[model samples]
Target: MAEEETELSDEQKKEIAKWFLLNAPAGEIQYVAKDLKSVLNADDVYNEAASEAFPVYNKSHMICLGMSGHFGDVLVTSYGELNENEYLDPKTAQVAIVDHVKQVCTEVRPATDEELPSPYIEEYRCALEAEMLKYVSEAYPKGVCSVYCINGKDAEGPGSDFELVVVISAARLSPQNFCNGSWRSIWNIEFKDDIQSLELKGKLQVGAHYFEEGNVQLDTKHECRDSTIFQSPDDSAIAIASVIRHHETEYLASLEESYLNLPDTTFKDLRRKLPVTRTLFPWHNTSQFSLTREISKELGIGK
Candidate 1:
């Protein structure tokens, strides 16, 4: 008779998962027959593992899973990475696993050179970043310089370690008064291998309106459009410009739709006419629309 195989408990499974995530060699693809729920239950473990294994501050290590029944050597099909937030999402993990199993496992063979992580990824990232920066500078003369990409905590607390930022601003007067207008957009660019994750965050103000619509949040329409994926940093920078230009057009449309024929329109009325919806920040009573516009225009974004 054949000997019975021992079954692993949830704890044991997590332990095994943590071990592989923590110690797996960079660019190596290791196979585990059982489906361990480690990726789901262990947030701290993933954070720790990524902290140790992340190729760079802007890039995350990739994780792939195999199905339970297969027994051949796991062959890595591609090389890529995700942001920490993207990596930790259970749905993303599941998709990667299922995709991997579907793409390979029918034959036994070593991963090809193309499937392996780049040997000089650090230098590669630096070169890519330089090219991206140059592109931003040349393509967007109005794009403001910022230190938001710095790698460490700020005086307030932890800060985003984004690789680059493109701040774009646009404003127009009431066609009569200099004190009336709207618009600002900022894109945080996190560079990955052959891809750039662009996050949109900014503020919108209307003529003499007290409330300001700002930041991408769950309840906002812009939230869904917040994170855009691009093939290159140059394309991502162009996207930033495109978003600002769209805002300019939207602002004009809002003026025509909401302000025309209506006298002394309130902020709420103007916002209702805008194309995009966003959370209105009303925390402080002193926050004025005219004031916000002045500050934004004078200092500009990324200052």
Candidate 2:
């Protein structure tokens, strides 16, 4: 079912306009106007603004004037990332914002040969020479950085003694052009023969929804799997298990805090806490890609 839109109040407009005026990128600031309405989209924009520091690009860009084409109240959309300053006409504001996005797109580029084989990749290559060198020489996986490539790394983990090293390779792509959200550009570690060295058959992908939104500060606690780390044939199991621990911790915490201030906290509630059944032994799938499926689906990447 579609939810009804709630209109913003006068106080809300004042707060929003205040924010827009303050963060308008040094010279982008124009004269502040009186009547701007704030549009809400579920919880992606406003609630996120209250809790997190998101990038400017993640905010809304489309500027819609209410038919008459004159500014009643100057507009403020998004959370100051892409703004239509009150000083310009609606059409001019939209054009200026589009150009701003174009400026941002120019900065994102595929890693070059000198850029590939990152420090982590170099570290892995130093560990095993024959497998890595042989794979690179034969595969020649060179196009876009993520295309025709291998990535390997010793994932520094918490708790366990397993020194897990993972490698992933995708050889069937050309150019594979990635935008801001594409896994190729977002992940900090990009390796060149890490996958080919391990001889794994799994497909590798680095797509993300947040990647396109361009917010680097959002918490990845909801991410069930780290794609590059999880696709490693050798280390995926241990890496996923580690992720499960974090997931379950967050899950349990959420469960405990829910339904606060309920009036039923009496002797009956105490009785509910008593155990009536034997402890159920737990079992886990220990799967990597299984956890990442949702992330991939949301990002429109295939299995």
Candidate 3:
């Protein structure tokens, strides 16, 4: 009889598959993603677990994780370089940015019942809005807006301290449109004292917000409709959208001298077509647009 082959479990195969995918050349993620299916001998299991859980990461892929994690699509921003010690590696920056947002959303929040808006979130919101106001660029174009300062991030290494602020912005849309939701974007920028570096990388980010009562929301994925809620009409919707959009715009601009590299990402502003929902606060009516989520990102800020 012929010798039989051993089949790896989905988890086991996915571990190996991740390595292959990471090492795969640019634009070959889809092609490499299939190796797990063959190794596992359980297509259904791989599909259920490993298919969407691909964590094949590199410096080229950054900024994909959103602050809220559920609202905006994981988007890619431009690539750039700074000094070595003061360097900006997209992969490390992505980890730092995503982790910072994760921390801000949950760790910083309304301390007392009387807390209006989170103090932490408000600071960044104000500072970020001020920067966006400087530009009449397409994304921020003159409009009544809202800013959610997700939080302030600071990393102290051997030679330098990296301070990053993560925020989301939204710009108003027409009240005439029944599905009124603002266009949104997320951003992260390193606050370098003098700024230096010449290395480069790319990043993508998406966001989501779920509540854990006193703490930040534990999860944003709603397993059941009744247990979760999404609300807000157009007025609140557009403000929400602009805030998220502003985040990335400001982040990208901060990394470069100007907007030349913005074309690869969210340079385009489109609040009119964006579907919106309040992921954290109860706006008015619940929103259920799958492609969009409204966090009111103020959960941890201005409280």
Candidate 4:
């Protein structure tokens, strides 16, 4: 990455500058600085707005606007950094910053196919999945796991990153309480090799439903008790555990505020917390894609 930095040419800088200028507001002076740090992609327009001692509107503010789309009203404010000297009034800063940004802005298009998948990302996903699968099979003899190659299109839109959903089934455990208790014991069997190095992804809800004779609904969390890893590899245990831990940590961190508000809680609340449907499963992705395509077709944007 460092070596690649030296190869960036004056033409590339001018191109970035052009993008900045086009996206700038109707009136602004565009100042092109060579050593600006990009907040997103390395090759994308860089931001030099922070380099000055005091906030002065510059070409970098235009770059920021171009990176963040112009459809919605955007307000940029400077909050006091660790140092107290960096404070700026939010309202005044918002207007001045936006005006400055508009003055030096340029239009930028979404990334093309050539820039979508970097070599490192493609290799990382492939290698990670393979290693996860092998680890699961070797460690958990009674459990089963499988991996599927997922295209970004069937879930989110084209610009979305590739996603992996893993499902695991253990014969000795029930699915309802599977994630709740003794997760470490289960993971011990699932990931016996280099567990720390593995980049666990996310947890998923996997289950099925049934109807009774009179059409009464039966809610069974572990409807499939066959002890088969139907969708993903057992190594997904790591990812699921990680997500659960994160959620717990976040919940605990907010406990003080939650406790303070508990006394005011009312019965029969209208607000919803979790989504009604299980969003982690493949079926949700299919439904979402179908709905999206239908909407796009209605809008005459379907390909």
Identify the leading candidate in terms of TM-score: 3
Q: What tens digits encode model 3's per-residue C-alpha lDDT throughout 1-303?
A: 986688666676656655665554323344455664576566666554433333323223322333333332222222221211111222112111222211122211112322222333333334544544443245545232223222232212223323222222332323233122223332333322334321111133322222224322111111101011111223222332354444455554554533454453444343323334424445454465321333333343321
Best by lDDT: 1
Q: Candidate 2 — worst ten consecutive residues by lDDT sum?
A: 178-187
The stretch of ten residues in a row with the least summed lDDT in candidate 1 is 86-95
TM-score for all models, in order of appearance = 0.26, 0.22, 0.27, 0.19
Task: For residues 116-187, write the lDDT of model 4, one tens digit per residue.
Answer: 324433343344445545555555454333232233313222223343333333222233432211111111
Cα lDDT tens digits, model 2, 1-303, are 997788776456445654764443211222111111233333433433432212232222112222122322122223112233221212122211222321122111222334233444433433333333343344434312111113232333222122222222222222233212211111122322434222222212332222233533111122223333423422533333343334434643653454242334544465544345444322364365566787788899965
Q: lDDT score, residue 183, model 4?
A: 13
Score residue 174 of candidate 2 by CA lDDT.
Answer: 22
Show model 3 residue runs off by greater than 4 Å: 1-12, 24-28, 35-40, 48-120, 129-163, 166-303
Alpha carbon deviation, residue 225, candidate 3 (Å): 46
Candidates ranked by TM-score, best first?
3, 1, 2, 4
Which parts of model 4 are misplaced by more than 4 Å? 1-122, 153-160, 169-303
Please give the TM-score that candidate 4 achieves against the real structure.
0.19
lDDT of each: 0.36, 0.31, 0.33, 0.32
